[model samples]
Target: MTSDPTVEPGPLARSSAVTVTLLAPVARFSLRARAGDLAALSGALGLDLPQKIGDRAAAGAVEALCLGPDEWHILAPEADAGRLAAAAAAVYDAAPHSLTDISDREVTVMVEGPAAAELLTIGCPRDIDRIAPGRGCRTVMDGVTVLLWRDGPERFRLDIWRSFAPHVIALLRTGCVELATCS
Candidate 1:
């Protein structure tokens, strides 16, 4: 895949109401366990796993997000990968659970400013107006799978696969340009 010039740092794209910023590397873990084992899993990882779909919980720099009844995505500093993985292994030992490291497989982008929601709506089908803070869901933007979450009132984050990062960034840049021209 070609490197997307739109994500080359130093403010790739912006408008009076929207700006897209690429985020630093972060650790990511994909977890799956039965509801009955959630408590144990949480105890093992020392992370409070979110219970409801779209719900998100954070402990310091680590965050646990529920993607489904039995699926969760954990995000933390890349340095914590080993420690977190060890905890998960110990807790799920002999139990029917799966924890996989996906830290290097994805990239995170931050979209902020007043028009952030409108910019996302250009390609994302979810109702950005309806997503409350502390909630997120797996969705597609321009056909690329993404994890969308609101980090603040006018700020949102998109976690996209590494290979698709360029495509998504390009889309965001184009959206920003269009929004700027219209306003």
Candidate 2:
């Protein structure tokens, strides 16, 4: 048997202490705006957009993470794509910012367990332990750009580009075994 890169991958890592699975589809957007425009956009989107790097705010099924001084990554239920775009569009005139729908460009991988943070450090450049819970940062894993979300002390969500997912998942699975043995 042979593997084909063109074909999308199936399941990812799974373990008792650490697991990696692809989350169900969600609507994602890359928003770029100035500080003064955040209030208006947040009102329209129904969620406040964090301004400081690594900060995050959420409302309902929607969450906005401040990835930079003027950039944010928004995630919401897939069904809310139209509603989100419409709301942002409505605010464009007043806020004058960019909200690009990036739902299809990347996929969410949830990595959670007692050793989740250590597992991530295998390839991630940052000291994963340093990120405060409920915050996120744009970082690199095995040279791949990823948005690392620290949902809790033991839970993480990696928003990674689809093309590099296979490589990243493979690394994580191998790390799971390494950590499992060290226990």
Candidate 3:
């Protein structure tokens, strides 16, 4: 399938209060396997799998996100998708599980600034203040499904479908403007 070039925009906005940056492309995979299979899975993937909900584990350029009891989302440099998929397939051989490449389906937008969490609270129901760094979960913003994660005390990353990226960035920019005016 061909993606619309017009929908992609660069650096939506920047401010001391909040700076929105479009992240470079990365490989993303959706994984579903039984908890019992984690050991082998981790060994095959060459990265420790996070065992707790909302937890994330990273080794080098690869990171694994535990989205559920038996589900995870893996992110890595675009060049490593094939290798990672191969490892997963080898590990899950004769086992029941699912692994899918979703790299091109979504885009990542990073929000960084002292008011980053506040800007996200405008549409997300989760209390951003409560989500500590290195953790994230699936949530919806303005009805758009997204994976919200805190990368640092003042930095947040939102993973949303490529189609919804523009709308989400616009909302974030609006929030930044509103916060600027309020302060």
RMSD of 1: 1.8
Query: TM-score of every model?
Result: 0.93, 0.93, 0.93
* lDDT (0 to 1) per candidate: 0.88, 0.87, 0.87
Question: How well is each residue in 87-160 modelled by candidate 2, as lDDT tens digits?
Answer: 98998988999999998888788899998998999999898889999999999999999999999999999998
lDDT of 2 at 62: 97
TM-score of 1: 0.93
lDDT of 3 by residue, 1-183 (tens): 225542354576777788888788899999999988888889888898998999999999999889999999999998999999998899776555898999989888889998888899998999898999999899998889999889999999999998887788789888888888877
- Worst lDDT run of 10 residues, candidate 2, spans 1-10
What does the lDDT read for residue 106 in candidate 3?
87
Model 3 steric clash pairs? none
Counting only residues 3 or more apart in sequence or on different chains, how many pairs clash (N, Cα, C under 3 Å) in candidate 1?
0
TM-score of 3: 0.93
